[model samples]
Target: MGELVDFFVRSRNFILFVLLEVLCFYFIINTSNYWGATYFNTSNRYAAQVLAWSNAANQYANLRQVNADLALENQRLNARLTQLLQSKPAAPAEYQADSAFADRFKFVVAKVVNNTTQFANNYITIDKGTDDGIRPGMGVISPTGVVGKVKICNRRFSVITSILHSEYLVSSQLVKAREIGTAKWDGVDPHLIKLNDISLTKPVSKGDSVVTSDRNSTFPPGILVGRVRTIGVQPNRVFHDLTLDLATNFSSLSFVYVVENRLQAEQDQLEKQVETEK
Candidate 1:
């Protein structure tokens, strides 16, 4: 108390000067129309700027929540779409009867927590795992196109073998020519991949769209793979060399969906039985 009083006494003149200065400026601004207008304009401008910054900060903080909501909404829409596609009438008489087709795939939305595009064997990590129903061999895709396949999973996270990986192969088909082929990364460019086994006889050309083949058990048929960027044929070669621009930009991937085929286990078992007999 004594120290504060002593300090105040020493600073009294300075305090008084500041207080009088403030009062004089206030009275002058209030009395003068031009000054008053200038003061209010300056103050309002500063206030508006402050409010804008505050609002921006608030929005930035809410982005994660907004993204999560969007993911859930997308999941709902995908489920509804799957149901509608499967509900189509098979035959005129069977239209009234129970639909033979049931929803075979379930989609789970997940955020990409980690990704790599530069490596020969790239991988992605998502914030979902066995607890979230993610499993090995499940196909992964973004809103734009296919991303990868789930490779490993635990309780709360799963790793995906990215489509950019050199060894990754996806069954693909050319849209216009209906030519079936295998899509694989050449380990040279992250933006491009090669589609092999397409016969030179097929009407493949630049700008042709390629998509997932119907024969794929993991990925849904007709999902976009990429567009043909270059096509070349070697002498006496049966197949044409195709370079494609990948649909999904792996470098910018954020959100992806893990696809679960409900009948995958059954299909695997049947295939295994057939293989064993052969």
Candidate 2:
């Protein structure tokens, strides 16, 4: 207490000067209209700036929740689009079957809990499983494009065979040429995938957009897979050597939607029965 008193005594002159300056400013602003208006305008501007900064900080803090909500909304939109694409206008005899397929797809939004892009066989793990209606062979996709297929599932989690996997295949098509081919990774580049079975005589070109083909059982038809980055001929191969720029960047994948095809089991069983008979 004594030391505080001594310190205040030593700085008394400076403190008095500060008080006098504040008093002078107060009197100048109160007595002069121009000074008061200028002071209030400057203060208001500073106050507004401070409030803006505060609001921005709040928004930044809530960004994760905002992203999750947006993903869920997109899941619904994507599900509806897939249903529409699969359901075409049918004749009266087939109207019931078409109507059944109109709502046969369901999309579940799941957070990517794990991902790998550096390996020859990359995989992704999501925070959903059989309990969430996820199943092996279900298709997974990001907001921008194709992701992978579900390989395994538990009650609350599922592992996906990413499109970067060496053995996984996606049925893809060139939008302009309408050529269907199998898209596969060569264990080389994560950004590029190889599309096979496109004839060299066909009008293949760079910058052509590639998308999931309608013959696929996994993803709905027409989901973007990649764009053609190069088209060339291999030395002894029968098909054109085409590379595509993948739409989904696996390195930064945060969320995905698992697509459930309600009729896939029946389709698979029918195909298996035909194969067995052969």
Candidate 3:
């Protein structure tokens, strides 16, 4: 307290000068119309800038929560879309009166904890597992397109065999031609994938859209795989050599949805029964 008082005494003259200067400016602004307008305008501009900076900071802080919310919303929309597509009738007579649209697929939103794309066989780890209803063989998809299939799962985490993996294969078809093919990574490019078994005679061309086939139990039908980038013919081969620009950018993958087909067990069991009889 004594030191503070001494310091104040020493700076009293300077403090007085500052106070007089502030009072003179305040009087000048208030008494002169032009000065008053200019002062207020300058103050308002500074205040607006401060408010904008504050708002931007707040938005940045809320980004994680906003992203989580969007992921959840996307899960709901994806589930709904799958259900609707499965319920669509092929023809008036083919539509069954007893066939009701059931939500067979459930979506679990998860954040990618780790991902790799440069290796021959890439994989992704997500912050969800058995506890979150994520299980092995479940299809994983990003907001933009198909991602991979779940390979392993623990109570709190799961790993996915990414589509970029050479061992990974997805049943896919051309949207325009309806020609079936097998989508596989060439173990060379992260942005490109190969689609095999599509015959050269099929009405396929560059820029044609490729998508998941309904025959695959792992992924729902029509989920985007990629766009046909190039088509080539190998001499004496029956099938066309094709490359696609994969829809999902694996390097930037942050969030994904694990798709659970509720009827998969029943379907597998029935198919097994047929196999046993045969």
Tens digits of per-residue lDDT, candidate 1, 136-225, equal 999998877889899999999999999999889999999999889999999999999999999978888799999888687788776799
Ranked by TM-score, the better of candidates 1 and 2 is 2
Worst 10 residues of 1 by lDDT: 93-102
Task: Predict model 2's lDDT versus the native.
Answer: 0.90
Writing each residue's lDDT as its tens digit, candidate 3 over 1-278 gives 99999999999999999999999999999899999999999999999999999999999999999999999999999988887778773448666522333567788999999999889999999999999888899999999899999999999999999999888999998999999999999999899999999987887789999999988888888899999999898689999999999999998898999999888998899999999999
Which residue pairs in candidate 3 collide? Answer: none
Candidate models: Cα lDDT each: 0.88, 0.90, 0.91
C-alpha RMSD of candidate 1: 3.4
lDDT tens readout by residue for model 2, 87-134: 762245555436666666788999999999999999999999998888
Give the TM-score comparing model 2 with the true structure, all chains together.
0.92
Off by more than 4 A, model 1: 1-11, 83-102, 274-278
Q: How many residue pairs clash in each candidate?
A: 0, 0, 0
